[model samples]
Target chain A: MISNEFYSQENHGPYELYSLGDFELEDGGEIPDCKLAYNTFGELNKAKDNAIIIPTWFSGTSKDYEAYIGEDRALNPNKYFIIIINQIGNGLSSSPHNSPDLMSMSDFPNVRIGDDVRAQHQLITDKYGIKEIALVVGGSMGAQQTFEWAVRYPDMVKRAAPIAGTAKNTQHDFLFTETLIEAITSDPGWKSGNYQSNTEIAEGLKRHANIWAVMGLSTEFYKQEKWELFGVDTLDEFITGFLQPFFQMMDPNALLTMAWKWQRGDVSRNTNGNLEEALGRIKAKMFIMPIDEDMFFPPRDCEAEQKMIPGSELKVVHSIAGHFGLFGGEGSYYHDQIDKHLNELLAIPVPDKVI
Target chain B: MISNEFYSQENHGPYELYSLGDFELEDGGEIPDCKLAYNTFGELNKAKDNAIIIPTWFSGTSKDYEAYIGEDRALNPNKYFIIIINQIGNGLSSSPHNSPDLMSMSDFPNVRIGDDVRAQHQLITDKYGIKEIALVVGGSMGAQQTFEWAVRYPDMVKRAAPIAGTAKNTQHDFLFTETLIEAITSDPGWKSGNYQSNTEIAEGLKRHANIWAVMGLSTEFYKQEKWELFGVDTLDEFITGFLQPFFQMMDPNALLTMAWKWQRGDVSRNTNGNLEEALGRIKAKMFIMPIDEDMFFPPRDCEAEQKMIPGSELKVVHSIAGHFGLFGGEGSYYHDQIDKHLNELLAIPVPDKVI
Candidate 1:
C-alpha cells in the first residue's frame, strides 16, 4: 500500500545499507557475508523500552510499512522509537537481486522465522544498543516474526500482536508456498536460480500473487465479486493482467527466499519437538488475533493455540476483509480493536522501564 | 480408505468404460471424443426418485469415495440407487493420458462446476436413463460440483451436501489451484504439456502430492511431529519418501485437467453473474458444512454462505484433520449430525418427481 511517489525517493531518511555479513540461517545452514538494507524512525528514548519493531512481509521492504511509522499512527515517531527491519528477501536488504556473490539455489539457506527474529535482534542489540521493545507488531509474514520474537526471546519484548498469522504451518499452506517457490526456481527464466539477461519471472511472481492474495481477502469478498473492484473479469485475468505488474517488478530470488521462510514458519521448531511446550515458553503477554474468515490463519487454528496459552488473549476480528481486516476496512472498526487491546496491555505497569 | 484388495479386483461393479462421441466442452471447444470411466452401486427404484449421486474430488477417481456408497451408509443400496460419477481428468474419464490428440496447455478449455454437473447430468439421462437424484454429495472440488448441481439442474436434485466448499473461488484457493497446475506445468519434464513421455508429468504429479499432503493436514499435526505417523522426519523426506509413490499411481494429464476445473469453480457462472441470485435458483435443499480445522474452507466462510441461503443448514465438523476431516477422522463424530439431517430430509413428504 506504499505509494509509488515514496518509492521514487533516493533513500528513506538516514539509513545504512548492509552486506552479506557472516551469519547462520534458521535451518542450521550458514550464508557467509549476507547483506541487509534497513531504516529507522523516531528518536530513541533514554532506556529504549519505547522502541517498536516492524518486520516486513513477503516482497515488503523497510519502506513497505513506512506509512504506519510516522508522527501520528500507532507506532508514532513522536512517542515510541521505531525500527523498520528489512526481511532477507527484500531487495534493499541482502537479496538475490543485489548480492555480489549470490548463493546457489541449493545453497540459499532455508530460513525460518527464528532466523528473521534473530537477525533483527542482532540489528537492534548489536548496532542500536536497544535491549527491550515495547511491542513488536506486524501483519502476515511480519506478524510471524512478531510471534517468533515472543517465543525466541521471551524477555526481549513486553507485548506481541500477531495478526493474520498461523501458530504453525498447515498442509494446504505448505503446498501453496511450495508451488510458489517451485514456480520461481523452475521457471525457464530462473536458470537454476541464476537467470541470464532478458528473463521475466512474471509467471512465477504472478503465481505467487495469486496464492498470496487469497490469504489477504476473505471468501465473502470473492462471493461478492470484488475482483471487479480490482478490475479483473476473471481470476485468470486477475493473475495475468492485473497481478503480473507487481510480480514483474519484484526480484524472483527474494520471492523464493521469502516463500521459503514462510513455508518453514514454526515456533515449535524453536522449542525442540514439542508444540505445547513451545506455547508455554512464550513468557511475553500475547494477543493472538486472526480474522475469522482468514484462509491462512483460520480462527480455529488460532483458537487451538489460544487454548494452550494459560492466560493469552485470543480475539477474532469479525470482518469480511479476512486477513487484511487487521489493517484495512472501517478505520473505526480496526483501530478500536487495536486501541482497546494495546491500551489494556500498556496499562499493565512495568516494574521498571528501559526508557 | 479403499482396501488394496478392492483395487486389485478386475471386476469393478457397475463401473462401465464409456466413451463420448465427438463432443464440445461448455466453452464451445470440441473434445472430438471423450470418455467417462464411472461406477454405479445399488439399484434405481421404480420411482427413480431413490437415486443418489456422488461426484469425485480433485485427483480422485470413482473409487475414491466408494466406501461411503454402501448398504449401511447414508447412500445405502437398500434405500436408493447410487452413481459415483468420475469427473474428467480422473484417468477413467477423457484426459491427455489416454486421448490420441492431446489438448495443449493454452488450448485447454476452461471447465467450470457447471460443466461437471452438466456432464454428469448427461451420464444420468443418457447412460442410466434415470431422471432425478435423492442426494448429490461431494467434498472439496466434489463439493463444488454438488452445489453446482443444485444451481444448474435444481429440479434434478432434491438435496445436496457440499462439505468444505464455497459458493465461489477465493483468492487463496485460486492460488493453490493455479500453483499446483503451474508446479506440474513448470517442471522441465512437463515440456509445456507436450511431453512425448509422461515421466516429467510423473514428477509434476509427485510435486502435486507434496502440496496436497501438506494442505490436507493441520499445522498441529506437523507440530506434533506426526509425520512419523506417515513415517517421515523432514518435509522433503516426506515428499520424496511417500507422496511420490501415491502420486505416481495416478495420471498426470488427469491431475492437470482437474486442477483447471477447480480454478474455474463458480455456481453463479451457470445461473447468472450474481452469486446470491444463483443460490436463489437452487431448488434442492443444501447442507453446507466445513471442517472446523479446515484451512481451505474456514468455518466463517460457511457461516457467511449459510446466512445468505434461506433455510440452508450450516454445521461445523470438529476435527483436527483439517480439510480431510469431512471424510476422515476417528469415527467421524460429525457423522451423527450428517445422519440426523439426512434422516429428516428423507422423512419429508415428497411431491411428483421432476424429469
Candidate 2:
C-alpha cells in the first residue's frame, strides 16, 4: 500500500492532521493513532458557532472539494468557517495505504460511516472546542456521514444537507458495490490486496475505473457526447486517457476498505433497521438533495428517505452528469444549482431549541 | 476452444447444421467450414411466404426462444414456419469454442451482425428455397441482425421488428460493452482468452454477471424487489444462484466473440456512417419496439432511430424488467406485448413493390 507515487501526502491538499490516539471504532475495531487529514477555509471565531463541516466522498481527497467552497460561492468562506474532512481509508487519512500499525495489505480494520462521523465529532469538540455546527453537508458517502452526524448528535448540528446519497444503502447499490469490489479482487495481481506496487494491480484498478465509467456517470452524459466537454474527442480516449488513468493511480486496498463499508451503510441500524425511527432522531433542518440523472442514488430513493424525516425537504439537483455532477464536472451547472439550494437552506435561522 | 463440457451441440437446442462451406464475411474475414445452427417449426407453405426468421440474442441458443412461439402466441408455429437461427459465435453455431478449424480461443475471426444475417439468408434460400420472408424480429444483438436483414435485403423482407436495440450503436453502449469485455479479459485466469476451462474464469464470469445485474435489468426491477418473482428471497441468493450461475456456464471466448461484434453493431457502416441514409433504405413495415425502462437501449435511443424510417412506429413495451424483459423472466407481460406488436406488423399486407 505504501512506497508508491500513486498517493503522496504533500499533494493531498492544504491540510493538517488531527490525531486520535488509539481511536476506537463503532464497529468493534480500533485504528491505532488514527489521523484525520482536513483542510479548512476562513477562521473559527471565539464563539465557534459559524462553523461548517464538509466530509469527503468515495475516492475523494479534501483537495477535490475546494471548488464547492469559495469566496463568491453560496458556501462562502468569508461568511463561514469551512472544513473539508477526508474520511478514513481515503489515502490522506489513516487508511490501509498509510497505516504503519496495520501494515499488512488487508489488515486495516473496517471503519463504518458512523465511525467517520464520530471521529469528525471528536475532531470538532477536542480541537476547536466547538459546541455547534452551522451546517454539516456532504455528497455520496459523505452524505451518509452527514446523515449520521445529524442523527448521532442531534443538538450539535443546526442544519444538515446530504447530497446524492441514501441513509440506508439499497439492495441494488450493495450489489453494485459488490461488482466494484470484485473488479479489484478478481485480478490475480491484486494478490489479496498485497500487490507489491499499486501498479502491480494496474489491470484491476483499470477494471475498477471501467465500472465507474459505466455507473459513476450518467448514460446521457455519454449519449450527448458530454465527454467532448472534457476535451476528449472519442469515447475510447475519454475512457483510456481520463477514467482508467484516474483509478489506476489509487490504492486498491484503500478503495476496498471504503467499498466494503459503503455496501453496508445503514443509519437504520441505529434503531434496529427502522429507518423512520432512526431519521426521527434528527433535530437538524434537513435538505435531502439527489442528482436528477444520478443512476446510483436517484431522486426517488432520496425522496423515500426524505419522507422519513419530519421537516426534511427534497431538493432534486438537475444535472446531466449524474453522480459525477457531485463536483460540478460540467461547466458549473451542478455547482451553481448546488449553491442556489444551499443558499436557500442556509438562510433559515436556527430554532431556539432542539426538537 | 473445443472439447469442453461448457458447450455441446445437443445441449444447445434441437438444431440442425446448415453448412456455409468456407463462408466469406463482410469485413474480409472467412470462417472455414462455417455452420449455422437452426431449429424450425411448422412447414414452409408452397408460396414460401409464410416463413418467419427469429435470430437469437447474445449468448442465447434456439431453445431459449421456444417460449416466445406457441399455438397461443402471435408467432404461432402452426401458421408461421418459425425459424430460430443461432447466430455465429453463440456456441451452438460456428463459435470460437466449436470451430475445429479455428481451434485457438482467440483465433476465431470477428463475426458481425451483417455476417449473421448473410449466413441466415444463405440458409433460408439454399435449404428452404424461400425467396420471400414473412417477418424478421429479434431483441438486443438479434435486433441488430434484424435491422441488417431488412436493410441489406430490402425486397426480400416483408416486415421488421427490432426490440431494445439501435440501428447504429450509441457511444454510451459502445463503452458499456467495453466494461463487459474488460470484466472477462482482465481476469488472470482468462490468459488472453485461452483459459483451460470456462470454470477457470468463474470469478470473471461472475463479475460479468454482476455488470449485467446493474445494467441488463431496469433500476425499477431491483427497486421493487422483483427477484421475488423469480422465487428468490434475497438479492444475494438471486445473484449467487440465478444471475451468476446463468453466465458461469457460458464460454468466455464465445461471449467475447458476440460482444465484440455487439460493440461495433451499426447498419449505418454500409452507408459510410450515415444512419439516416442507411435506415432510409428499409422497406419492411418497421415497428421499432424498445423496452420502456431499459437502461442500456433506452426508448429515447430507439425512438431516435425509428423517426428515420419512413413509416416506422416506436412501440415502447412498458416493463420494469428493462432489457431482461426480452425473455419473459417475470410473468407473461413481456411476451404478451411482443405478440400484440408482431401480430399487427405481420398482418400488414406486403406491398407489391419494394419501397
Candidate number of the best DockQ:
2
RMSD of 1: 5.3
TM-score of 2: 0.96
The most accurate candidate by TM-score is 2
> Per-residue CA lDDT of candidate 2, range B1-355, in tens?
4566655656765788989899998778799889998999998998888988998898888887888899998899899999999999988888887777454578888879899998999999999888888899888998999999988998999899998898888877877788889888877788887777888888888889989998888667888888875568877778898889989999999999999999989999889989899999998999999998788898988998999998999999988878888767765777888899989998899887432
Least accurate 10 contiguous residues by lDDT in model 2 chain A: A1-10
- Give the residue spans of candidate 2 off by over 4 A: A353-355, B6-10, B101-104, B353-355
Question: Per-residue alpha-carbon lDDT of model 1 for B15-119, expressed as tens digits?
Answer: 676666666678777665666677777788777788888888876777767656556567677878878887876656656555554554334555656766777
C-alpha positional error of residue A44 in candidate 1 after TM-score superposition, expressed in Å: 2.3
Docking class of 2: medium
Query: Mind giving the per-residue lDDT tens digits that candidate 2 earns over A1-355?
Result: 4665655656675788999778898778688889999989999987788899999899988887888988888888998999999998888888887878454468888889998988888998899888899999999999999998988888989999999999989877887888889888887888887777788888888888888888877767887878765568887788899888888888899899999888888898888888899999998999999999888898988998899897889999988878888867775777888888899889989876432
